[model samples]
Target: MSTPQLLMIEDDARLAQMVGEYLTQSGFGFHHALDGASGLEMLQQRSPDLVILDLMLPDTDGLEVCRRIRAMPSNALAKVSVLMLTAKGDPMDRIIGLEIGADDYLPKPFEPRELLARIRAVLRRRGEGGSDAAPAAVMRFGTLEIDRNARTVTVGGMAADLTSYQFDLLVAMAERAGRVLTRDQIMEAVRGRELEAFDRSIDVHMGRIRAAIEVDAKNPKRILTVRGVGYVFAKQQD
Candidate 1:
Protein backbone atom coordinates (compact mmCIF):
# COMPACT_ATOMS: atom_id res chain seq x y z
CA MET A 1 0.00 0.00 0.00
CA SER A 2 1.15 3.53 -0.66
CA THR A 3 2.04 5.64 2.33
CA PRO A 4 -0.87 7.79 3.46
CA GLN A 5 -0.39 11.36 2.24
CA LEU A 6 -1.00 14.18 4.72
CA LEU A 7 -1.02 17.93 4.20
CA MET A 8 -0.21 20.09 7.22
CA ILE A 9 -1.30 23.75 7.13
CA GLU A 10 0.02 25.49 10.21
CA ASP A 11 1.65 28.87 10.76
CA ASP A 12 3.67 27.72 13.76
CA ALA A 13 7.01 26.70 12.30
CA ARG A 14 8.21 24.71 15.29
CA LEU A 15 4.90 22.90 15.74
CA ALA A 16 4.74 22.14 12.03
CA GLN A 17 8.24 20.67 12.02
CA MET A 18 7.45 18.51 15.04
CA VAL A 19 4.23 17.22 13.51
CA GLY A 20 5.88 16.62 10.15
CA GLU A 21 8.66 14.62 11.78
CA TYR A 22 6.18 12.56 13.74
CA LEU A 23 4.05 11.79 10.70
CA THR A 24 7.10 10.97 8.61
CA GLN A 25 8.32 8.51 11.23
CA SER A 26 4.85 6.98 11.29
CA GLY A 27 5.23 6.06 7.56
CA PHE A 28 3.24 8.89 6.09
CA GLY A 29 4.15 11.08 3.11
CA PHE A 30 3.60 14.59 4.41
CA HIS A 31 3.84 18.16 3.13
CA HIS A 32 3.48 21.49 4.90
CA ALA A 33 2.37 25.07 4.15
CA LEU A 34 2.94 28.05 6.39
CA ASP A 35 -0.28 29.81 5.52
CA GLY A 36 -3.77 29.06 4.25
CA ALA A 37 -3.09 30.37 0.74
CA SER A 38 -0.14 28.09 0.25
CA GLY A 39 -2.11 25.30 1.79
CA LEU A 40 -4.96 25.84 -0.63
CA GLU A 41 -2.49 25.93 -3.48
CA MET A 42 -0.97 22.66 -2.39
CA LEU A 43 -4.40 21.10 -2.05
CA GLN A 44 -5.33 22.11 -5.59
CA GLN A 45 -2.06 20.89 -7.02
CA ARG A 46 -2.24 17.45 -5.42
CA SER A 47 -4.92 16.28 -3.09
CA PRO A 48 -3.74 14.46 0.02
CA ASP A 49 -5.35 11.59 1.86
CA LEU A 50 -5.87 13.85 4.86
CA VAL A 51 -5.40 17.51 5.82
CA ILE A 52 -4.25 18.88 9.20
CA LEU A 53 -5.58 22.43 9.01
CA ASP A 54 -4.96 25.26 11.44
CA LEU A 55 -7.84 27.67 11.98
CA MET A 56 -5.83 30.86 12.37
CA LEU A 57 -3.64 31.13 9.32
CA PRO A 58 -1.88 34.29 8.08
CA ASP A 59 -3.91 34.42 4.87
CA THR A 60 -7.36 32.86 4.50
CA ASP A 61 -8.74 31.13 7.55
CA GLY A 62 -8.85 27.37 7.86
CA LEU A 63 -12.64 27.47 7.96
CA GLU A 64 -12.66 29.12 4.54
CA VAL A 65 -10.24 26.55 3.26
CA CYS A 66 -12.57 23.80 4.47
CA ARG A 67 -15.51 25.48 2.79
CA ARG A 68 -13.61 25.79 -0.45
CA ILE A 69 -12.57 22.17 -0.28
CA ARG A 70 -16.15 21.09 0.29
CA ALA A 71 -17.32 23.27 -2.56
CA MET A 72 -14.91 21.55 -4.90
CA PRO A 73 -16.28 18.98 -7.29
CA SER A 74 -17.36 15.87 -5.44
CA ASN A 75 -14.86 13.74 -7.29
CA ALA A 76 -12.02 15.99 -6.18
CA LEU A 77 -12.91 16.05 -2.50
CA ALA A 78 -13.90 12.41 -2.21
CA LYS A 79 -11.69 10.26 0.02
CA VAL A 80 -9.88 13.34 1.35
CA SER A 81 -10.39 13.69 5.10
CA VAL A 82 -9.80 16.96 6.93
CA LEU A 83 -8.79 17.31 10.60
CA MET A 84 -8.92 20.87 11.89
CA LEU A 85 -6.44 22.09 14.56
CA THR A 86 -6.78 25.32 16.46
CA ALA A 87 -6.27 27.01 19.80
CA LYS A 88 -9.94 27.85 19.95
CA GLY A 89 -11.70 25.27 22.09
CA ASP A 90 -15.05 26.94 22.36
CA PRO A 91 -18.04 24.80 21.45
CA MET A 92 -18.97 27.25 18.70
CA ASP A 93 -15.52 27.05 17.14
CA ARG A 94 -15.66 23.27 17.08
CA ILE A 95 -19.15 23.38 15.61
CA ILE A 96 -18.06 25.82 12.90
CA GLY A 97 -15.10 23.67 11.98
CA LEU A 98 -17.32 20.65 11.60
CA GLU A 99 -19.99 22.70 9.86
CA ILE A 100 -17.45 23.76 7.28
CA GLY A 101 -16.67 20.10 6.53
CA ALA A 102 -13.77 19.10 8.78
CA ASP A 103 -13.68 15.40 9.51
CA ASP A 104 -12.42 16.09 13.04
CA TYR A 105 -11.09 18.89 15.27
CA LEU A 106 -8.36 19.08 17.91
CA PRO A 107 -7.58 21.97 20.21
CA LYS A 108 -4.09 23.42 20.19
CA PRO A 109 -1.33 22.63 22.70
CA PHE A 110 -2.19 18.97 22.08
CA GLU A 111 0.17 16.05 22.32
CA PRO A 112 1.55 14.71 19.06
CA ARG A 113 0.50 11.21 20.13
CA GLU A 114 -3.10 12.33 20.49
CA LEU A 115 -3.00 13.96 17.07
CA LEU A 116 -1.57 10.79 15.53
CA ALA A 117 -4.25 8.70 17.20
CA ARG A 118 -6.99 10.97 15.90
CA ILE A 119 -5.64 10.77 12.34
CA ARG A 120 -5.52 6.99 12.51
CA ALA A 121 -8.99 6.81 13.98
CA VAL A 122 -10.48 9.03 11.29
CA LEU A 123 -8.87 6.98 8.54
CA ARG A 124 -10.09 3.75 10.09
CA ARG A 125 -13.62 5.07 10.38
CA ARG A 126 -13.40 6.00 6.72
CA GLY A 127 -12.66 2.34 5.93
CA GLU A 128 -9.02 2.66 4.98
CA GLY A 129 -8.06 -0.90 5.99
CA GLY A 130 -11.03 -2.71 4.48
CA SER A 131 -11.37 -4.45 1.13
CA ASP A 132 -12.79 -2.50 -1.80
CA ALA A 133 -16.06 -4.43 -1.60
CA ALA A 134 -16.64 -3.33 1.98
CA PRO A 135 -19.44 -0.82 2.27
CA ALA A 136 -17.38 2.29 2.91
CA ALA A 137 -19.49 4.47 0.71
CA VAL A 138 -22.97 5.88 1.00
CA MET A 139 -25.67 4.66 3.40
CA ARG A 140 -29.32 5.44 3.00
CA PHE A 141 -32.04 5.76 5.64
CA GLY A 142 -35.46 6.72 4.34
CA THR A 143 -35.39 10.28 3.01
CA LEU A 144 -32.11 10.80 4.81
CA GLU A 145 -29.03 9.66 2.91
CA ILE A 146 -25.45 9.73 4.13
CA ASP A 147 -22.66 9.55 1.59
CA ARG A 148 -19.76 8.56 3.76
CA ASN A 149 -17.53 8.29 0.75
CA ALA A 150 -18.23 11.90 -0.08
CA ARG A 151 -18.94 13.12 3.46
CA THR A 152 -22.24 14.61 2.37
CA VAL A 153 -25.85 14.26 3.45
CA THR A 154 -29.29 14.76 1.99
CA VAL A 155 -32.67 14.98 3.71
CA GLY A 156 -36.03 14.39 2.02
CA GLY A 157 -34.33 14.40 -1.38
CA MET A 158 -32.58 17.72 -0.70
CA ALA A 159 -29.06 18.48 0.37
CA ALA A 160 -28.91 18.78 4.19
CA ASP A 161 -25.51 20.54 4.35
CA LEU A 162 -24.65 18.92 7.68
CA THR A 163 -21.35 19.09 9.48
CA SER A 164 -18.99 16.13 9.20
CA TYR A 165 -19.60 15.08 12.82
CA GLN A 166 -23.32 15.49 12.41
CA PHE A 167 -23.23 13.26 9.36
CA ASP A 168 -21.31 10.63 11.32
CA LEU A 169 -23.77 10.78 14.20
CA LEU A 170 -26.71 10.45 11.83
CA VAL A 171 -25.05 7.54 10.08
CA ALA A 172 -24.49 5.81 13.40
CA MET A 173 -28.16 6.16 14.31
CA ALA A 174 -29.24 4.98 10.88
CA GLU A 175 -26.94 1.98 10.99
CA ARG A 176 -28.77 0.78 14.10
CA ALA A 177 -32.18 2.09 13.29
CA GLY A 178 -34.93 1.28 15.78
CA ARG A 179 -32.33 0.17 18.31
CA VAL A 180 -31.49 2.08 21.43
CA LEU A 181 -27.82 3.10 21.55
CA THR A 182 -26.36 4.48 24.73
CA ARG A 183 -24.26 7.62 24.80
CA ASP A 184 -21.09 5.59 25.09
CA GLN A 185 -22.18 3.36 22.22
CA ILE A 186 -22.97 6.29 20.01
CA MET A 187 -19.68 8.01 20.85
CA GLU A 188 -17.71 4.86 20.13
CA ALA A 189 -19.49 4.31 16.86
CA VAL A 190 -19.20 7.87 15.60
CA ARG A 191 -15.90 8.95 17.15
CA GLY A 192 -14.22 5.54 17.10
CA ARG A 193 -13.24 6.09 20.72
CA GLU A 194 -14.58 6.65 24.21
CA LEU A 195 -15.19 10.12 25.57
CA GLU A 196 -13.45 11.42 28.67
CA ALA A 197 -15.29 12.33 31.86
CA PHE A 198 -17.84 15.14 31.59
CA ASP A 199 -17.54 15.20 27.80
CA ARG A 200 -20.81 16.13 26.17
CA SER A 201 -19.51 16.16 22.61
CA ILE A 202 -21.80 13.30 21.75
CA ASP A 203 -24.81 15.29 22.86
CA VAL A 204 -23.67 18.25 20.81
CA HIS A 205 -23.24 16.13 17.71
CA MET A 206 -26.64 14.50 18.29
CA GLY A 207 -28.33 17.85 18.71
CA ARG A 208 -26.80 19.06 15.44
CA ILE A 209 -27.90 15.88 13.70
CA ARG A 210 -31.42 16.31 15.01
CA ALA A 211 -31.52 19.89 13.80
CA ALA A 212 -30.58 18.78 10.31
CA ILE A 213 -32.86 15.76 9.97
CA GLU A 214 -35.74 16.36 12.33
CA VAL A 215 -38.64 18.58 11.33
CA ASP A 216 -38.68 19.95 14.82
CA ALA A 217 -35.37 19.64 16.60
CA LYS A 218 -36.99 20.74 19.89
CA ASN A 219 -39.28 17.72 19.73
CA PRO A 220 -37.15 15.38 17.71
CA LYS A 221 -38.96 12.42 16.14
CA ARG A 222 -36.11 10.96 14.16
CA ILE A 223 -33.78 10.80 17.14
CA LEU A 224 -35.67 10.05 20.33
CA THR A 225 -34.16 10.28 23.78
CA VAL A 226 -34.70 7.11 25.78
CA ARG A 227 -34.68 8.81 29.16
CA GLY A 228 -31.71 7.65 31.24
CA VAL A 229 -30.49 4.98 28.83
CA GLY A 230 -29.50 6.97 25.76
CA TYR A 231 -31.27 7.45 22.43
CA VAL A 232 -32.84 5.55 19.54
CA PHE A 233 -33.72 6.16 15.93
CA ALA A 234 -37.48 5.99 15.87
CA LYS A 235 -38.59 3.58 13.18
CA GLN A 236 -39.92 5.41 10.18
CA GLN A 237 -43.22 4.28 8.71
CA ASP A 238 -43.44 3.30 5.09
Candidate 2:
Protein backbone atom coordinates (compact mmCIF):
# COMPACT_ATOMS: atom_id res chain seq x y z
CA MET A 1 0.00 0.00 0.00
CA SER A 2 0.97 3.64 -0.39
CA THR A 3 2.46 5.63 2.45
CA PRO A 4 -0.35 6.09 4.93
CA GLN A 5 -1.78 9.59 4.97
CA LEU A 6 -2.12 11.48 8.30
CA LEU A 7 -3.70 14.71 9.46
CA MET A 8 -2.72 16.41 12.74
CA ILE A 9 -5.25 18.78 14.22
CA GLU A 10 -3.32 20.69 16.89
CA ASP A 11 -3.26 24.31 17.99
CA ASP A 12 0.38 24.22 19.09
CA ALA A 13 2.16 25.72 16.14
CA ARG A 14 5.66 25.04 17.45
CA LEU A 15 4.87 21.46 18.30
CA ALA A 16 3.12 21.00 14.98
CA GLN A 17 6.14 22.26 13.09
CA MET A 18 8.44 19.87 14.94
CA VAL A 19 6.09 16.92 14.36
CA GLY A 20 5.72 17.75 10.68
CA GLU A 21 9.47 17.45 10.17
CA TYR A 22 9.61 14.13 12.03
CA LEU A 23 6.64 12.62 10.20
CA THR A 24 8.16 13.60 6.87
CA GLN A 25 11.22 11.53 7.74
CA SER A 26 9.09 8.65 9.02
CA GLY A 27 7.39 8.01 5.64
CA PHE A 28 3.94 9.54 6.09
CA GLY A 29 1.98 11.87 3.82
CA PHE A 30 1.19 14.47 6.47
CA HIS A 31 -0.89 17.63 6.83
CA HIS A 32 -1.62 19.96 9.74
CA ALA A 33 -4.55 22.17 10.75
CA LEU A 34 -4.45 24.64 13.65
CA ASP A 35 -8.12 24.25 14.61
CA GLY A 36 -11.02 21.78 14.53
CA ALA A 37 -13.06 23.51 11.80
CA SER A 38 -10.27 23.48 9.27
CA GLY A 39 -9.41 19.96 10.30
CA LEU A 40 -12.93 18.71 9.49
CA GLU A 41 -12.94 20.47 6.13
CA MET A 42 -9.52 19.12 5.19
CA LEU A 43 -10.51 15.67 6.45
CA GLN A 44 -12.92 15.46 3.51
CA GLN A 45 -10.31 16.79 1.14
CA ARG A 46 -7.54 14.42 2.31
CA SER A 47 -9.35 11.26 3.37
CA PRO A 48 -6.31 10.35 5.41
CA ASP A 49 -5.73 6.94 6.93
CA LEU A 50 -5.07 8.19 10.46
CA VAL A 51 -5.62 11.37 12.47
CA ILE A 52 -3.43 12.71 15.32
CA LEU A 53 -5.86 14.87 17.22
CA ASP A 54 -5.05 17.15 20.12
CA LEU A 55 -7.57 17.02 22.93
CA MET A 56 -7.36 20.76 23.59
CA LEU A 57 -8.07 22.89 20.55
CA PRO A 58 -8.63 26.64 20.45
CA ASP A 59 -12.15 26.45 18.97
CA THR A 60 -13.51 23.10 20.19
CA ASP A 61 -12.63 19.97 22.13
CA GLY A 62 -11.02 17.07 20.26
CA LEU A 63 -13.64 14.64 21.58
CA GLU A 64 -16.31 16.56 19.68
CA VAL A 65 -14.25 16.40 16.52
CA CYS A 66 -13.86 12.67 16.99
CA ARG A 67 -17.63 12.32 17.35
CA ARG A 68 -18.16 14.25 14.13
CA ILE A 69 -15.67 12.05 12.28
CA ARG A 70 -17.42 8.88 13.35
CA ALA A 71 -20.77 10.40 12.36
CA MET A 72 -19.61 11.40 8.89
CA PRO A 73 -21.47 9.70 6.03
CA SER A 74 -18.50 8.59 3.95
CA ASN A 75 -17.35 5.13 4.91
CA ALA A 76 -13.73 6.15 4.50
CA LEU A 77 -14.08 9.18 6.71
CA ALA A 78 -16.30 7.62 9.35
CA LYS A 79 -14.09 4.61 9.89
CA VAL A 80 -10.84 6.51 9.76
CA SER A 81 -8.79 5.77 12.86
CA VAL A 82 -7.99 8.47 15.44
CA LEU A 83 -5.14 8.93 17.96
CA MET A 84 -5.69 11.53 20.65
CA LEU A 85 -3.02 13.54 22.43
CA THR A 86 -3.62 15.13 25.81
CA ALA A 87 -1.88 16.33 28.94
CA LYS A 88 -0.30 13.62 31.06
CA GLY A 89 -1.98 14.54 34.33
CA ASP A 90 -5.68 14.53 33.45
CA PRO A 91 -6.79 10.91 33.21
CA MET A 92 -10.33 11.96 32.34
CA ASP A 93 -9.17 13.40 29.04
CA ARG A 94 -7.99 10.02 27.82
CA ILE A 95 -11.13 8.23 28.98
CA ILE A 96 -13.40 10.80 27.40
CA GLY A 97 -11.48 10.57 24.15
CA LEU A 98 -12.03 6.82 23.93
CA GLU A 99 -15.67 7.16 24.93
CA ILE A 100 -16.16 9.35 21.89
CA GLY A 101 -14.58 6.80 19.50
CA ALA A 102 -10.89 7.67 19.39
CA ASP A 103 -8.97 4.57 18.38
CA ASP A 104 -6.01 5.29 20.68
CA TYR A 105 -4.46 8.03 22.80
CA LEU A 106 -1.02 9.24 23.85
CA PRO A 107 -0.41 11.60 26.70
CA LYS A 108 1.37 14.88 26.02
CA PRO A 109 5.11 15.43 26.78
CA PHE A 110 5.80 12.03 25.25
CA GLU A 111 8.78 10.90 23.29
CA PRO A 112 8.52 11.04 19.52
CA ARG A 113 9.25 7.33 19.32
CA GLU A 114 6.33 6.50 21.60
CA LEU A 115 3.97 8.58 19.52
CA LEU A 116 5.19 6.85 16.37
CA ALA A 117 4.67 3.45 17.92
CA ARG A 118 1.11 4.37 18.93
CA ILE A 119 0.37 5.77 15.49
CA ARG A 120 1.65 2.63 13.75
CA ALA A 121 -0.15 0.27 16.11
CA VAL A 122 -3.49 2.05 15.74
CA LEU A 123 -3.17 2.14 11.96
CA ARG A 124 -2.18 -1.52 11.76
CA ARG A 125 -5.02 -2.61 14.00
CA ARG A 126 -7.52 -0.61 11.92
CA GLY A 127 -6.11 -1.27 8.46
CA GLU A 128 -5.38 -5.00 8.67
CA GLY A 129 -9.07 -5.93 8.63
CA GLY A 130 -8.03 -9.21 10.30
CA SER A 131 -5.87 -10.31 7.36
CA ASP A 132 -2.59 -10.61 9.24
CA ALA A 133 -3.87 -12.53 12.25
CA ALA A 134 -4.76 -16.21 12.30
CA PRO A 135 -8.44 -17.05 12.16
CA ALA A 136 -10.22 -17.93 15.40
CA ALA A 137 -13.47 -19.66 16.22
CA VAL A 138 -16.64 -17.60 16.07
CA MET A 139 -18.21 -16.82 19.45
CA ARG A 140 -21.92 -17.05 20.23
CA PHE A 141 -23.38 -15.76 23.47
CA GLY A 142 -27.11 -16.17 23.12
CA THR A 143 -28.38 -13.21 21.13
CA LEU A 144 -24.88 -11.82 20.72
CA GLU A 145 -22.85 -13.20 17.81
CA ILE A 146 -19.13 -12.58 17.33
CA ASP A 147 -17.50 -13.64 14.08
CA ARG A 148 -13.78 -13.54 14.62
CA ASN A 149 -13.09 -14.53 11.05
CA ALA A 150 -15.21 -11.69 9.71
CA ARG A 151 -14.43 -9.32 12.58
CA THR A 152 -18.10 -8.55 13.04
CA VAL A 153 -20.55 -8.57 15.95
CA THR A 154 -24.31 -8.77 16.17
CA VAL A 155 -26.59 -8.41 19.18
CA GLY A 156 -30.14 -9.70 18.93
CA GLY A 157 -29.73 -9.88 15.14
CA MET A 158 -28.75 -6.22 14.96
CA ALA A 159 -25.25 -5.23 13.97
CA ALA A 160 -23.08 -3.58 16.63
CA ASP A 161 -21.01 -0.74 15.26
CA LEU A 162 -17.73 -1.30 17.08
CA THR A 163 -14.37 0.22 16.30
CA SER A 164 -11.45 -2.08 15.54
CA TYR A 165 -9.97 -1.71 19.03
CA GLN A 166 -13.32 -2.33 20.72
CA PHE A 167 -13.87 -5.43 18.59
CA ASP A 168 -10.48 -6.85 19.56
CA LEU A 169 -11.16 -6.11 23.21
CA LEU A 170 -14.55 -7.83 23.07
CA VAL A 171 -13.07 -10.83 21.33
CA ALA A 172 -10.35 -11.10 23.96
CA MET A 173 -12.86 -11.28 26.80
CA ALA A 174 -15.27 -13.48 24.86
CA GLU A 175 -12.58 -16.02 24.15
CA ARG A 176 -12.32 -16.62 27.87
CA ALA A 177 -15.92 -16.19 28.84
CA GLY A 178 -16.66 -16.75 32.54
CA ARG A 179 -13.03 -16.03 33.41
CA VAL A 180 -12.08 -12.59 34.61
CA LEU A 181 -9.01 -11.18 32.91
CA THR A 182 -7.16 -8.30 34.46
CA ARG A 183 -6.36 -5.21 32.41
CA ASP A 184 -2.78 -6.38 31.86
CA GLN A 185 -3.94 -9.78 30.70
CA ILE A 186 -6.48 -8.25 28.33
CA MET A 187 -3.87 -5.92 26.86
CA GLU A 188 -1.48 -8.81 26.48
CA ALA A 189 -4.08 -10.92 24.71
CA VAL A 190 -4.87 -8.15 22.27
CA ARG A 191 -1.62 -6.30 21.62
CA GLY A 192 1.13 -8.42 23.21
CA ARG A 193 2.38 -5.19 24.80
CA GLU A 194 4.00 -5.05 28.22
CA LEU A 195 1.72 -3.71 30.91
CA GLU A 196 2.36 -0.29 32.37
CA ALA A 197 1.95 0.67 36.02
CA PHE A 198 -1.19 2.72 35.45
CA ASP A 199 -2.80 2.06 32.09
CA ARG A 200 -6.51 2.76 32.47
CA SER A 201 -7.53 3.01 28.85
CA ILE A 202 -8.75 -0.58 29.13
CA ASP A 203 -11.72 0.57 31.19
CA VAL A 204 -12.54 3.32 28.74
CA HIS A 205 -12.38 0.89 25.84
CA MET A 206 -14.56 -1.53 27.79
CA GLY A 207 -17.16 1.16 28.31
CA ARG A 208 -17.25 1.83 24.58
CA ILE A 209 -17.60 -1.88 23.86
CA ARG A 210 -20.46 -2.19 26.34
CA ALA A 211 -22.25 0.68 24.71
CA ALA A 212 -22.03 -1.09 21.39
CA ILE A 213 -23.15 -4.57 22.53
CA GLU A 214 -25.06 -4.43 25.80
CA VAL A 215 -28.83 -3.94 25.78
CA ASP A 216 -28.34 -1.27 28.40
CA ALA A 217 -24.87 0.15 28.80
CA LYS A 218 -25.78 1.70 32.15
CA ASN A 219 -26.44 -1.81 33.50
CA PRO A 220 -24.36 -4.24 31.50
CA LYS A 221 -24.94 -7.99 31.59
CA ARG A 222 -22.73 -9.24 28.80
CA ILE A 223 -19.42 -8.01 30.24
CA LEU A 224 -19.52 -8.00 33.99
CA THR A 225 -17.12 -5.87 35.99
CA VAL A 226 -15.46 -7.78 38.81
CA ARG A 227 -14.92 -4.58 40.79
CA GLY A 228 -11.16 -4.57 41.42
CA VAL A 229 -10.29 -7.71 39.45
CA GLY A 230 -11.25 -6.47 35.96
CA TYR A 231 -14.02 -7.76 33.60
CA VAL A 232 -15.49 -11.05 32.47
CA PHE A 233 -17.72 -11.97 29.55
CA ALA A 234 -20.83 -13.92 30.42
CA LYS A 235 -20.55 -17.59 29.58
CA GLN A 236 -24.29 -18.02 29.73
CA GLN A 237 -26.23 -15.46 27.75
CA ASP A 238 -29.90 -14.60 27.92
The CA lDDT of each predicted structure is 0.78, 0.85
- Please give, for residues 1-238, the per-residue lDDT of candidate 2 as tens digits: 5788889999999998888889879988889999999999999999998899998999999999999999998967988888899975777777778888888888789788887778777776665422376476678889999988777899998988887788888988988989989888898887833435776778888888899998899999999999889899989869
Model 2 lowest lDDT segment of ten: 125-134
Candidate 1 structure quality by residue, lDDT tens digits, 148-210: 666678878777756545666787888898999999888877666555656556667677677
Q: Which 10 successive residues of model 1 have the least lDDT summed?
A: 126-135
Per-model C-alpha RMSD: 3.4, 2.4
Output the number of the TM-score-best candidate. 2
- Superpose all Cα atoms of candidate 1 onto the true structure and report the RMSD in Å to 1 decimal: 3.4
Q: What are the clashing pairs of model 1?
A: none
Model 2 sits at a Cα RMSD from the real structure of: 2.4
Q: Alpha-carbon error at 13 in model 1, in Å?
A: 1.8
lDDT of 1 at 182: 91
